[model samples]
Target: MTGPSIVVAGGGSAGHIEPALAFADAVRRLRPDARVTALGTERGLDTTLIPARGYPLELIPPVPLPRKPSGDLLRLPGRVRGAVARVREVLSGVDADAVVGFGGYVALPAYLGARGRVPVVVHEANARAGLANKVGARFAEAVAVAVAGSGLPGEQVVGMPLRRSITGLDRVALRAEARAFFRLPPRGPVLLVFGGSQGARTLNTAVAEALPGLVRAGVAVLHAHGRGGQAAPPAPGYVPLPYIERMDLAYAAADAVLGRCGMTTVAEVTAVGLPAVYVPLPHGNGEQALNAAPVVAAGGGVLVEDAELTGERALAELLPLLTDPRRLAAMGAAARASGHADADERLARLVLDIVYRHNLESARGAVGSDDRATEVLRPDPRVWRQQ
Candidate 1:
């Protein structure tokens, strides 16, 4: 099959953008001649990250649907119509064969614009479906999810698409180099702590207060405090940085992880076979806790409430795990078993399958077989919606 021109859409945070980029990379790998265009909002991190990764990103105005009565709510219809119109223009200009949506403000427009004209594939990274994905799924030919029971129509558990750097990481081989890079001790179990890209104050404070106990237990600390946050005054065995550019290296150097259970973070840590203690964010729709449930159930990690994650609580729980090599190894093995390293390839295959099916239907339609073409071209009722 000739490479199909595809539009991949999503952005805002690394969670959505990362998966979209990973999937795009996979498509290119499968079809070197593939022309992949990314659609994202200008307000998102994609303005920088997408171009840096060498993919062309077309900017769209964000169509944020206000949930409550307000001025933005009143303007919602106009905003959505404008965004969708702009997206449709881009799709036609690019001659897109299909669209893959990874659920964000940008995804709704992309999905709406491409619904009837192209094969639409929606990927939901969270265990719980987001609002954008919920609407996208209504018209999507295929719906992929990171976890089971996402409540989206036609949902298939294709796992999360991880970057090549992370999927190809060799933690065992790079252990020494990683330790040296992070200025960690040559010998001693390392505990890696991070929240998201913005850093969680709860995590930082808890870990800081617990550092003395962790250090006394011969556990080295490598903390990524996010932007503007610093490590609690420098102490022996504690290394803190505002952000970690190379997370693969940090994973390689760590014996266990302490952080929030965002889908990307949990997926990456488990993919690399790292035991973790996940603290789901206290706010939002409670999806973070849901994201961590499977990992904790699989014995790959532990889940702690945000309120319970104090320095004292951390020491009480993590000290024993860090000290016991056998237990740590067992947890790592469980994590590796539970993680899906081939998720990128799996999702790519799904997208290609949809494209191929659409092509076959288009060819049949061109042959003038009205009944056959209609049957082939009709949208599946399970996914199709009037709006």
Candidate 2:
């Protein structure tokens, strides 16, 4: 018998793509015979990263909804129609049993195309719901979120779907290897800092200015400044790189983190039990601050306004935390308590449950069953109950 086919959709930044990939990996692990296809746009990072990770990627035209009245807004209907048509073709070709979306331009079409035809599952990765996900949630059979109260219908907080490297990481056992990989001294406490994939000018500048103070306080630094960003000048206790390919190593090497509060960053740091100092982006929809709120409330991290995160301010706040082992250890434990390392598994199980229910519905329809018990769908109660 041909195994069930699943379509996983999302891609733009690493935030969306990584989770989609993690969920796909989980599905493959759980059901080796399952066929998984990734739906993404050519315009985003998915074009390169998806194929590189060994998944067959189906491309769809991007239908970006314009916030303001413009030419793009006028043409939006035609673009959406085309994208949805393309998604339908892909879904039919794969005989998709379920469509799982991680919320991106590509996901909106997948959700629309699969609605009423197959089971649809949506995963919202931010505290603030994006337009794509907001719409998808309305039609989705199962809606999952990384943060609570995300303004979506039937939202279940399943945490972020994390990469296997992160979920399976043994930070304590790999500490020596990670430190050696970065060429840092094995003895001192190392602080890891980075913005998102595109890098943050504010963080880069503040850390550059604060390096002397950190070095003096016996703290070593591993800085991934993002692609094309200027590296800090060499110092005895500082290591600077434009990008970090092996983030698991970086996390393993660090005692604490100083970074933005993007959903993926917050999830990864807390999963590994690393204390953090989060500086939410000053601009945008203010979701970053909301993303870091639960962790901060849990005493896993501290949140500072972007404006207040100066070199001196960072040193003043971080120095005390770095010097105090007991406080750092307490914060680490709190972080781990707040994080869900099994998020990928939970999401994968949700997908499978949707597929199972879809198959059952199909079977019921074929038999013309009138029994309410046969019609009533119950997913794995344990999986659905994950908060």
Report, for every candidate in turn, its global Cα lDDT versus the true structure: 0.87, 0.88
Clash total of candidate 2: 0
For model 2, residues 128-242, the per-residue Cα lDDT tens digits are 9988899999989999999998999999999999988998899999999999999988988899999977688888888988999998889999998989677677888799988
Candidate maximizing lDDT: 2
TM-score of each: 0.93, 0.94
Candidate 1 has a TM-score of: 0.93
TM-score of 2: 0.94
Q: In order, what is each prediction's RMSD in angstroms?
A: 5.1, 3.2
- List clash counts for every candidate, in order: 0, 0
Clashing pairs in 1: none
